[model samples]
Target chain A: MDKKSLTRRLGRPVLGTVAALAMTAGMLGTGPAKAAESFKIGVVTFLSGGAAESFGVPAWNGGKLLIEALNRGGEVPAPYDKKGFGGMTIEYVLVDEAGGATKQVQEFRNLVQREKVDAVLGYVSSGDCLAVPPVADELKAFLILYDCGTPRVFEEASYTYVFRTAAHAAMDNISLARYMKSKGIEAKYFAGINQDYAWGQDSWADFVASMSVIQPGAKVKTALFPKIFAGQYGTEISALMREKPDLVHSSLWGGDLQAFVLQAGARGLFKRAQVAFSAGDHVIPQLGNKMPDGIILGARGVNGLAAKARPNALTTWFWDAYTKEYKVFPVQAPFRMVQGLLGLKTAVEKAMVANGGKKPNAEELAAAMKGLEWDAPSGRIQMTLGGGHQAIQPNAIGRTKWDTAKGEMTLIDVEYYAAECVNPPDGTKAVDWIKAGFPGAKCK
Target chain B: MTLLRSVPAASALAFAALVLAGFVLPDWAMFLVTMAFAKGLVALGIVGLMRGGLVSFGQGLYFCIGAYVSGLMANWTGITDIFLLSLLGVLAAGAIGTIFGPLLANYRGIFFAMLSLSLSMILYGALSKMTTLGGTDGLNVAAPTFLGYAPEGRPLGLALYLYTSAIVVLVGGLMRGLFNSQRGLIALAIRDNELRIEYLGASVRTAMAINYVIAAVLGGLGGVISGLAIGHVDPEFSFWTTSGEFVFVAILSGYLSIPAVFVGSILLEVVRSFSNLYFPNTWQLALGIFLLLVIVLLPRGLGSLTLRRRKAKEQA
Candidate 1:
């Protein structure tokens, strides 16, 4: 074929294809330009994977219930009575937070850029929580990390659009330690076994620091950090038994916690030491009668069975709604989720009122959330830490009593520590504050 | 020989098309393509290994090494240059592969698979325990610069897409060349009959070791690009499931052409993304069903469709 004919043949098709692609692009660009009638929020949690049953599913369920209640209008109490955010029906894009931090980052971007969600609330993994904030900042999207317990998300970087609605991992351990102190439990030599990850390590560090402050003479005997999700704890349990410390502390959760409890209980490891779990409430229902009696445990906050038995109106509503739908009692994951949605609802409403009942932009929403205080099922959650980007909430720790008649584990002798006592105050890092004997802490 | 010679021109054309796509495609599509290409490079490594009758179940070891090297470099040294970080990642993976290659090359079948898996798990265990690397939370990678120019938002995404496309094309061409080379043939021959290769005075172990190192390099390249693209790296990169995903893509590609790996990766991502969107509760089941369908319909994999068509044309 001659060059002219070849060029004529190829050029026409190429030009036509380019025109078609441009038209398609133009059409797609027009699709999302229409003014949104509903306030879209992206809810990301573990819909699959190992953490799904304990953390991801429950949090997602909580989010679903809250959204349903909010959309139903007047189902929740005042300040959140309006249907959704300022009478705009709440629509959600649910994204699974299973595929690691890298995948979560991509999914986060998709939620903001593609799904065009105004706000995002959910992250069960500390890794994902840490990874997502910068992206949220970059996109100028409002993000509320509901379940991840990492304090480093806010400490590592300053962000206006990113806020964690639940207390950091530090609060759980500090409360557990303080509860022991208040109970006059003698723990001179303490041993700890945590999952070898950020959440576990941070919890252990905080626990040690809090113990040092509360029980000034206490010393760390031995500590074991088994890998996260390590189903087998034979060696670690044996090591803990060999140490034979007066008190054993752990922050392991989900399946790992369940597996450890079963293995340790069978091995009579609990008989040798007064065991304390910083975040063990999630496993109580799963463990049932298998859970040992008189074991001290915390639920990251005043959540699960540890929360007030004669609950307030909001707590009763949330517990009932969640239980009706999921057929299980609300755990820390759901507690955090409910708190996040409630806080988001309040902030969005405030912003909407400021904007004359119009849906607030990301900046307005973030502004409303900063330093905001609201009631949660657990108690009041204040964005007081991380320059009002991280939450500080009261946490309850108590001893577990396995009721054979009920075939369930219940928290008895529950003690609630005020948020100020558990969380590091403004301008002070959690680890630094704890190590410095909780300077200026208001322990009650 | 013809196929080998055509690789460069084909790669250049593909590179141009992808570069154009970077500008034309929407943000989400561009991001998805970038991810698929990055993952495809790892799948390519698995493809190479599979061609030699070896299936690695722990390519994630090298992948995580590359990701961590890039992430740690960005975190500790403030080196945001993608080129420098990727080079370091490749070198790090290659160094680790070289150290372990001799030991790994001696095994085959499930033994080889399990050994590689064990090695990756060891890295996963170590990474999960190391607080300096942020433990399970891992560490964030700073936004990378291109030739000293830092870009953000759309510009950043476009830049990353272009850079990733260029790497994919270059690596694809190199892989094609390797497959056509004498050494590649020797490796394939060893897979079929190691005794014959040994009798012919060619060391099967050395060939296997070389292939292993090359696969490691490819995996590391994928890891670095992905880690940089996603702006985070964690121990999950080295987890067994991560490696299994790569293997799944390799099988889906049927150890076929270089482009097949990319296609397979994209398909997997699409299935995963859409499933997660529509069937949040049963996304895993969706993926399982899709895989079953693909296996049942196209036992050799999705790439077999193209091969079968080509064969039909040749016969006619």
Candidate 2:
């Protein structure tokens, strides 16, 4: 048990381990050396969490499929036919967004500072979207917010390095109210049951504001703000039934939406009053026939069944490829993720063209993406809001019916709203615009 | 007692080495190390409680208070000075501890743990509903400046890392000094038998209260550093899961050494970061397995290794 004998036993292994660590550390710091080689993207989504099953997993799945296809080269349609991001060979570093905002910020810094990723496409949570932008701006890294629906991201502050290539919550709710009014669905009174957090609250506020304008005389009977992911809706449904309004509006999605449909449908609340959901079409495939007929829904844009009727070349290829891979029709989550990735790819390639067919830096990428208009499976998306940072895309609303042959709930009487028809103009906030009676709205 | 005289010199050298490493380490590595040190301070507080045979599950109470105070100061006053923010955090958390410490000293064992647990959860619930305070999404903190000297990017990260290391060194030395003092021995005696200490006229309540106050101060300081380093603060700072992490590090390092706490914390961050990088899908499974192995093989924790080596030397 002498010191010399203990040292003899442990010294070699300890020294060897230390040497290995040092070598690895050196390898990790091989940052800019690899920048000229391939275009590295940090694709962050929820690999694990409650959101993983329905939202995050599908988003990452679609992202992986798209990135791999892009790497394979010429699979995607025109203008995007070139190899991985103008033939630089697109590489990805996937990080889970399951952890909270602080963890996300740290991981973001790691991606840019350590991993040397040229750009990052991430986040399905609104909190994370708002949290990451300042860090992105500080680190001078280009970040594309794939699916976070918070308007506050671009509304609160302008950032040189941040962009959300998918439409925020305003369009979803605004489109819902406009669709209801255009169809003349209901006359007098309405109630709402939405989640209480930022997403739900913001959605409810937007819907109410839209209702106040579009359906001017409709009185609000009641509004219930259930907590996010509060799966049970018994009491909320009971309260809604008790109010006995002509219509019920909700922005509930994912599990909360599913649970509300089941609980309220069992109580025959839908029969008592017409129900409309913002961002609800993703649940149709999961709900099948159980999703009540005559219920109105939006896929945040021309997504899911709304896009089924319009199969352009790019749309047809993306739709078939995604269905072939995942074995289910693509929903809003996957569609939004693909849209963000596609937009990022287009921007990178555009920047490369300007840079004489070389990799573009963050500033170059940002410049290329500013006010960029591009095609998506959801139709054309334009950077028209938040001073060319936030996206404004076409969105649709439809009435659902249980189709016998399809053995699923499918949208009927679908109506598409152009990007300008739903989203607010640049320098105008969504709520303020809605409250001001949709001034300067282009409805054609 | 004479053997303890070299602690200040040894610790100064150790701290000097750590600060020097900040100059050479990459920004991300510096950030990771900064986090380990900040979180390690909370573990050190838990270790302080461990010495007194009390485990405070509500250390998050102080942690959150420290963070919110510091964050609010930055947001409200535009004073982004790290020293002033940390001073506010320490003072606010210290005052809260002073008020609650004696009340908490009245309980023991599970009762003590649960009481602390409830206090933090209350803060969590309360913060989640405050819209002006940013609610569940929380508020962002700007990168703090060092005494009016604003550093950006690499230099900023390095400055924060070095500053945090210096604080840890000073506070850790204070803790080490307390452990060697007669008051520390009295706290340990209170742990062994409160009834005996009371019978010996040592005022067990006062000793326990003092120990609690020390933990609150440590927790607050740790919280301020963490909140500023991460550049964001939220109710999650007070969540039970966050407190549980501090406890986990405390158990991993044991109460034997202050330096061992940072090692354990760094080990955890490294394991977590690498595991997540390598195994994105099942990183939780990897982390759970790693923790299980640590608990099984090192019952007294990694700190026990040092204790065993010292004992072996004595025997030889």
Candidate with maximal DockQ = 2
Off by over 4 Å in 2: A1-37, B1-5
TM-scores for the candidates = 0.92, 0.94
Best by TM-score: 2
**lDDT (tens digit, per residue) of candidate 1 on B190-258:** 778989999999998898888899989988999998998888888999999999999999997786577
Alpha carbon deviation, residue B55, candidate 2 (Å):
2.4
Model 1 per-residue lDDT tens digits across residues A1-444: 986566544543543353345334432442254346688888999988889999988888887888888888899876567787778888888888888887888788777877788899988888898888888887789999998888888888889899999988888887878778789999879899987778778888888888988898999999898877789999998898888899999988889999999999999998889999888888876877788998998888889886646498888888888888878888888888889998998898889878887789999999999999999888899999888888999888888887778766778898888899888888888888888888888876
Screening candidate 2 with a backbone cut-off below 3 angstroms (N, C-alpha, C), the clashing residue pairs are none
The ten-residue window of minimal lDDT in model 1 chain B covers B293-302
Give iRMSD, candidate 1: 8.3
User: Candidate 2 - CAPRI tier?
Assistant: acceptable
Q: lDDT (0-100) at residue B152 of candidate 2?
A: 88
TM-score for chain A in each prediction: 0.91, 0.93
Model 2: residue A2 alpha-carbon error in angstroms: 23
User: Which parts of model 1 have CA positions greater than 4 angstroms off?
Assistant: A1-35, A232-239, A266-272, A325-327, A402-410, B1-5
> Hey, what RMSD does candidate 1 come out at?
6.0
